[model samples]
Target: MNNSVWNVTSNSNLDTLALSHSTVDFASHGSTAGTFATLNVENLSGNSTFIMRADVVGEGNGV
Candidate 1:
């Protein structure tokens, strides 16, 4: 059986709510055969009073 894999290509945007449509950018890369990555809301933006969340999904397969 093949293992499930997930990775973060980039955050690239942390859509802010209080700043009238602002965003922050982040980036990461990794490898996995049966693992996943997660970026916390706190890591989204350096600015206080800003919030971010993600339900993103990624996949990988063997050749």
Candidate 2:
């Protein structure tokens, strides 16, 4: 996923979000209602951009 954008509007939740690529973009949706409990990222290479809010992480499985 290179230069990808995920728009989380409202009432959105994710159990496990796994992404393997050079670049991934959440469109800075860490502040909105969209959230994820677990994030699995693979292929840690060069020039990778993962924009996810801290509060949006680990917010799954009734956390």
Candidate 3:
């Protein structure tokens, strides 16, 4: 028999939030028109589903 204890946690909560003003000028200068991502699931077994999502917040009207 083996007795072990481990603790894992995450602290990623934002305390305050503020959006950019309307007059602020911001643009996506990089090449962000078409983008794609891939994942290798060879080791994943049993009942599993791949979930992909994106949380995008466009700052001002230029983004």
Candidate 4:
């Protein structure tokens, strides 16, 4: 499986509540046998909050 990932960060500290959103899309070449996907977050510190909402909309054998 091929992996394509990205990361985003803020230069300065956030004093107020910050709203952020991210979207990741994965595609399996021509052959669509069995595929696995995952998402991970690392190094969370200070008075920070992390909320992840995933909305998967697709049409295929396994979506």
Candidate 5:
């Protein structure tokens, strides 16, 4: 398999970011286990916080 990891970039007026109301868990099937995440940001706007580029954003929040 090829190694190709990436993150989403955003253009925002806000200079900071904060994760709120997020939950994470893991599921196991036989000998393997996978991770999951769930995130909720009721309000997304500028003059507030930025969309953070994280490896884990709770059930996998990605672009």
Candidate 6:
């Protein structure tokens, strides 16, 4: 689990911002078989442009 915050103050606009996650795993069986992941962002001013991108890579071992 992780938590992060960013504060920016500039006359010009931001070109790009990136977030990444690698090798997230889930239990094979039992009560922990399923998991939940979430990402939350708050813009106090509520007046900004945002572009989000996600990539998921899966590898199964016949579980």
Q: What is the lDDT of residue 38 in candidate 5?
A: 35
Clashing pairs for predicted structure model 1, backbone only = none
Residue range 11-32, candidate 1, lDDT tens digits: 3333432322333222224334
The estimated TM-scores of all candidates read 0.18, 0.31, 0.21, 0.22, 0.20, 0.18
lDDT of 2 at 5: 52
The residue-by-residue lDDT of candidate 4 on 1-63, one tens digit each, is 113222222122333322234323333222243443443434333333333333455745576
Indicate the worst ten consecutive residues by lDDT in candidate 2.
37-46
Q: What total of clashing residue pairs does each candidate reach?
A: 0, 1, 0, 0, 4, 0
Supply the TM-score for candidate 4.
Answer: 0.22
In order, candidate lDDTs are 0.33, 0.47, 0.28, 0.33, 0.30, 0.29
lDDT per residue, candidate 2, 1-63, as tens digits? 344554443343444454444444454445445454334434334344566555636778775
> Which parts of model 2 are misplaced by more than 4 Å?
1-23, 27-34, 56-63
Best by lDDT: 2
Model 5 agreement with the true structure over 1-63: per-residue lDDT tens digits: 012221222222433333343321122112223322333445543332223323444665563
Q: Rate residue 53 of model 1 by lDDT.
A: 38
Least lDDT summed over 10 consecutive residues: which range in candidate 4?
Answer: 1-10
Off by over 4 Å in 5: 1-33, 47-63
Cα lDDT of candidate 3 equals 0.28
Clashing pairs in 2: 37-60
